[model samples]
Target chain A: MLDVTKAKIIHDFAHDRPLLACRYDPKERFVVTSSEDYRLQKFSLPGGEKTILPEAHNSWVHALGLSPDGQILYSGGCDGKLVFWNIADAEVKPLRTLDAHQGWLRTLSVSPDGSLVATGGNDKTVKVWNTQTGELVKQWQGHAKNVYSVQFMPDGKRILSGDLGGAVQLRSLDADDIKGNFEAKPLHTYEGGQMVDFGGVRCLAVRPSSDQFAAGGLHKATNPLGAVHEPLALRFAFEGNQLLKSHVSEGITGGGLWRVQWLSDGTLMGVSGGSSGGFLIFWNDQQDKDFSKFKLPALARDMDLSTNGLNVVTAHHDGHVRITRLSES
Target chain B: MKCPYACGSTEHLMARRKFLSLSASGAVGVAGGLGLLTRGAAAEQVQQKQQRIVVFNMHGGLSQLESWDPKPGTRTGGPFRAIPTSVPGLHISELLPYTAQQMHHLCLFRGVNTSEDDHGKGAYMMMTGRRQTPAADYPEIGAVAAKTLMPEDSSLPGHIRVVPHGGGGRGSDAAYLGPKYSSIHLGNGNPPQYTKRPDGITDEAERRRQEFRRKSDRRFLDGRRTAMTDVFTYSFEQADRLMEQRDVFDVTKEPTQDQEKYGTHDFGRHCLLARRLIERGISFVQVSHSNYDTHNENFDFHLEQVGEFDRPFATFVADLAERGLLDQTLIVVLSEFGRTPNINLYLGRDHWSKAWSVLAGGAKLARGAVLGATNAEGTEVVDIQVDHAQLFHTYLQAVGVDTSASFQIDGRELPIADPSAEPIWTAIA
Candidate 1:
């Protein structure tokens, strides 16, 4: 089991601005990050050497995906363009670029076998593309609002997407119709006083050892524009899209967790930000509250767990890409 | 590209020619445009008889990056996309698609740098067209319009403000403009509070009471009459007349189809009421849609708040145009200031007064014109930059009011708009 009490920060790589997304190289060579400055950068694992890539996006890049074989990387940006990069290229430049959406592209997920990539956008669309050719395999526009999160299921035959209205729709690769929809209503709010709908499914994680998944967001938005709310995560059964448990905690006051991941030991981890500062909270399926937690240096926008499950990397607004060792020093 | 629809109409061309001809002549000079109001009474009469203005105050700081001056594909543009409008190449954020369809009737004045980031100060500058100074207090445009456009025989109060969520009261924003032109707040689509007569008093009883009060007022003021007393009497009579026609403020009486078209939200109802007042011949109507401060979750709130704002605003404009009020009415969409171009750590934008946009339309103003430009990243205005004073002059000038002229008040000649800034000439018809 992952021991939250033993986790300690081993490295804090400072950058110029807030980082939005972070991912570990499959070969354990480096860690990649996209940030508020619209730059994609890589930090070497041991030495913490930094390499800033050439300009590939004119806007903030929010989603990054590495192929299973670890040779290719795909980045989706608020500019709605998706760019492909060869990881081993001495001169790091875009290999191919596609104008993938009508508006901001928010999230992208590489399929289990790395044959396809699924992406979501502010255009209320979920699109699947052939990874090798960068050809759009199929595109669907069914969300009532902006699509904030999307993920390819472990089976590779299905995909799930979440929207601004807190709707999680399940779909099949072979069909155009929706297989099912799980309404994560607690993760959404239509604040009448402000006449605004705030909060959405911000992040999603699939349990590695079980047929279950979790969606992370915020609720109780008494004042959404003011950033008043609490963090909420819902665990669901993958078989019928049944909601099984709701994980919540106290003393948030404001802000929410936007990134989540499943740990090797079946613990669920989420990185939160906003007025509540930054925190990493862990939960188990049997409990309705977090089992353990650790505070972050500042607000964390995104987080990732390495394949080896020993290092936890968090992207923070303090301009630090922090690496936390999960085991004893 | 210049909009084809606004300029192509045969009647519009004739009007445009007449407008242009007048704009060049000494007989139709605006105060700020031609340096002085030398046209005498002909222009003053036209200004009094023809002009109307509706102001939409997007309370709190609205995000220019998400509304008028979208920099989609840029780092600071957030996650919204900019979409094309009816005005050919002019585009706004997708959050305002409904408003985009009405863009042909409006001009995007994209280069506004008011330079006042504080809420109270910025609001004062935008509304009165002057910097806030301890030495001077200026009336907002609404009060100015109400006083300037008052018909000789009309008892109806010309200034009205519609807010759907607050308690109604008479506003004191008139400043030096006097209480006679102050705004009567219409709260929550309900008519001015206490417009209805008490059950205990019949019409005859009310008439008798009013007659007695007027007689007492005349007798008491006969020896000690003052300017303040006259102002009070005039305001009371206006209020009495409004009570008789109070049903006009009840928006539920509007057609169900009309109500549905504007949406059922608070902002929507307020917009409907604004249109109703405009159609009722009120010279100045201000409707506010608010809570756009957006210190966090900027995208989500804008997606919702701007969405709520879009349909109602468009419907108000289209309905006025359909009713032939567009020719005489000036519509202004304004805010205290705009949110920053920088996307902060909370995914929110801070106060940015350096560069932004304001939407102006109708009256005799130029249609389908883009008055200014912001660079690709929207960090600054790259062309035709104008400030609040210039905008104030432009709005007054659009209604044929000479911004250079002074209002003769209490033996003092107070200049109407700021003398330091002139109207935006390119925005005029």
Candidate 2:
């Protein structure tokens, strides 16, 4: 079980601007964060040593994806530019920058083999890039609105993309025999909730076994303007893209889940907050109820879990990177 | 005298004289004679090319940082950036890219100090140009324009409000100016009820029915001379005039290309209708865009709301300019107030009134002009602060109304604007 009764903040690092995206190095020795100040910084875990890479993007850097080998990182910003970074050096170095999208890039996902990087953007297109060569591999146009999140299934031949209209589509990455060229075919689609018109799926997590995936976002807008709704986390069986279950934090007043992740032991976690406050909630497969939850000082924009699953770090709108510890089973 | 409708027949004049004789009374006799005299006066007013006003009321407070005045890169600026407009140094939020292209036609006021924060009170103050008082009711700007600028023989109601979602708050009434100047509220892109003749009724039959009803109503109203009775009598006459030219409210009369340019959303259609009404010589047209409260998820909701607003508004302005109405029509974009500059814990902004922004253009108002300034954090006005009364006076002046005039309400002279306030002269030509 996930225990938050003994949860404690391990470290808190401040940046010049709100940190929007974060990723943990494969060895778990460092954490790289992107911020609205257009800078990316690397912080050494435990020691808290910070190295800032100036001018990382022309505008707010919103999405960060790290290679499986931890040797390279990809950053996408509102300037519509996507850049590849070589993080093996003492300082992060830009390998190449590609004018990827026509609008703000919201989410990025790397294939399991690290050969392809999938990007979702405000242009309403899902684009795959050759990570090493910095070339455009494929682009799929199916989302009716801004594409918010994309993820590669563990099998690495299929992708899941979500949009502002709350549509989740499973697409094939391989070329069809009749087409003779790589064209993403929509395999399945899941409509999140009646409130899908109010918001889109913001974060998606595929299980380690690739048999199930969870999508998180707001379930409804209580008012016409404010997104004061229940933060919803839906778990779906991959076989048919069937919705198996849904979870929400009881008594939580306001906010929508901005990020979701599945722990190695199958604990599903969601981070969300709005004007009332922020929350970090965890749910296990055995029950629909949240097993544990911790409140944060500010809204958590994004989060990354360490490989061992003992530590989870969150980037916040208040310019603080909060590190918290989970009880070991 | 020539008939206003130019039907080249004396039948309309005979009908007017007959209606006047039926309702003639000691109290209404003077009003009837003055009304006839004003018809000639109205021709003179029209000869001067009477200016018109269109108030785009953003019902709930819109965020100044997201629309007119942006403090990008600040802690409270959210994720959107500020982009340069056609004006050299003026910058507005990137969310309004389409409006930005039309900046040369707009004058932005970023330093407004409306002290009331509550929705009802703020709306009252902004609409009536005066603080709430227990002594007397105040006239809204639309009502004032209806009384002061509309041609006496206008077939359409001078003051009209197109409320799509619903009414925002109080203060749309004519108050002391009486119900005759009150706004004619229309539903979401639909014509006012009873406008169309019933399926089985012929035009001549309908006219005969109206004449019979008017004769009975005049008899019933002969001794009952109250404000309520006057309002009822006025409504009947207005409805009769409206039936003759109801096509002005038919937005479908516009071509498909024009409709597509304004977009298909309710707000867009309302704007297109506002343009049509203005073209038909409406004195004041208030089109309200609802639900900008945005107490949480400010940036996300703004992207949706502003994205929907930008294209239609920009297109409307451009169309007005292309049709040569820009010089004679005054366009006002306003809200009750603005949202707080402090980004709340919910990632939203609460209601704020101390410092905000409003956009005005046309009627020879200074173009490409940005007046006033807010502090670095947008928490307070730093330069040339304008209050609700001053802004209202400026609007009146832009539309060629005498801001210094007063209305004789209940035997007391009430100033059109706040007595102590002056127009923002720098904003007007």
Candidate 3:
């Protein structure tokens, strides 16, 4: 009898350690997480009150990006560093730490006119930088492993990344061009499973209005490191980039799909649970029905659809910082 | 032959007593001289400094009438009452007066039995000590201690999961230890900015771009090698030792009188950043404190959830025993199965997994006392029972690990604590 109602725990940041990647703040009123205790915090959304940037970064802060003019914030760490914060006065300082990569910066992409950023690491290289001049503007270096999702393609001159060999590559923010048009790609590529068998291409989203995208795999060398043969994909994009309708959502027999979003009325919201009852679902706009679910209290990793679309922040794996409420009807 | 020249000051005092009898007969040969400064002050008064597991996940199950198997004056013990603690026969539930003044460092474990009363298989059998596989997928003991203690090199992150969302059954993994032994998830820890350094960038261009990416990664590894050459040379030496200790996640360099004794909450600044990430060595950290799937009001919702766990858990166990760090830190509260020794009809309690309770104290557990028991109709475990592989071998023998170790998988040889249950070693200490 509860579709989604009790909202008032606001922000329970417990983490003796288990919060991996979370982002929000294009006005969802602050929420940023990434840990294994190397730190990167900032929470206020719906009054969870926490503001200790802890000097922003040094390690383990893997992937974060908010600058669509939310006044800068881009992190990506595990000491391949790369920080760029300034969320206004609560500043823990770090306009640039760019250790640039030898490994572990894993994925970040910002450029819907925030003036370029891009990043991807475990050092197979994919940087771009320049967020209004902290420099290091171009460097793509064809992935051979470790790139794990990057995206800019809302047409800021293309860029999509996804590696560790599941291949998604697209590049070209031009520095006199450096190879990576690998032919109008990732309109769809879900061959994840075996080939070194660790399952890569973990996440990718793109659908604020619709070119209709979504990708998530994760199964890094089995036993359960985020397993997935195909946990979620959606595709869509018509007219020459081809790939009209692709859908894929029923294979969730036990925790796998890392993340996938798309809700602006085009509706697609997501969150795949694990350890058995991790729901959140949403889907409408007929992506094959099933328009509701809420049960979660664990493992909901990365969700955001609130520039006032009636909040939905989420970033879990037991760090519990939810917001919920996309629609009741 | 010595007798012939014997007069040179008695052969230089018999060669200075044979060089002081060969330096006291090589006393275990310089075991690092002076016994390594008295074994580094006897491992600094018995090696402690690494203990972190702040779970507290009361996610959706809260009634033994109100807390701790209470049966009160019976009729299925609804209204709540039972008080008294600090240890004498451990009473509990005057709606937990600050956990009855820290019940002598809590142990509880009121005999929890299980059958998965659904919250998705009872929160995936209480955060993955195991059960819920349909083919692979088992990695949640904080993703197996973030795949056994996170430091394969350490750019910090051998397992961290604050505000975690899914770490139970299908996937909350680092399972066969990939995704580089996963876990570094914070999608939310109040506002640690998803892990920080998103914009203000200035530790001198983050230490001159980490000394220009360690001189362009030593000139691009001067002649590469692949298959992730030892995971890219141990992730570039843990990304240059996590870019020179990124100020150990700087809680504003602490001391606003220790952030007002960690109680302004967001789970008390994630338990004071999990005691500064286990005093900076990070082996496994898991600050969950979630929704507690409460089915209904259930005694004014546990009198405001047991006063939000009695003052941030008695100020995070007296701030880890005033920084000596609670005998190596273990903490644990736990919940995903407990509630309803009958109360329902809408007052709510529901999901009872046979018997329920789990409190656990710091690292070397077995402290003070209490192991298992239940009866007086709390439901089951009539005596000693403990499951979840004996609570993951009593949390791997309270940290000294070695639950028979092993690992290999898919070709056999498992162990790493699962040897089909054993470690209740009376709760180990």
Best by DockQ: 1
Per-residue alpha-carbon lDDT of model 1 for B123-187, expressed as tens digits?
Answer: 99999999999998898999888766644345567788887576788998887656666788987
TM-scores, all models, native as reference: 0.80, 0.89, 0.24
For all candidates in order, the CA lDDT equals: 0.81, 0.77, 0.59
The lDDT of model 3 is 0.59
Better of 1 and 3 by lDDT: 1
Each model's DockQ? Answer: 0.35, 0.34, 0.01
The chain A TM-scores for the candidates, taken one by one, are 0.96, 0.89, 0.32
- The CAPRI quality class of candidate 2 comes to acceptable
Top-TM-score candidate index:
2
| Model 2: lDDT of residue A256 | 75
Runs of candidate 2 with Cα error greater than 4 angstroms are: A1-7, A175-197, A224-227, A296-298, B1-47, B166-172
Per-residue accuracy of model 2 over B66-169 as CA lDDT, tens digit each: 99998877767777789999999889999999999999998999999998889988999899899888886688989878777776556677788888753322
Work out the iRMS of candidate 2. 4.4
lDDT of 3 by residue, B139-224 (tens): 56665554444333234655666663322212236554333445555434432233344478876887787568656754664454
The pairs that clash in candidate 2 are: A274-B346, A275-B345, A275-B346
Highest lDDT against the true fold, candidate: 1
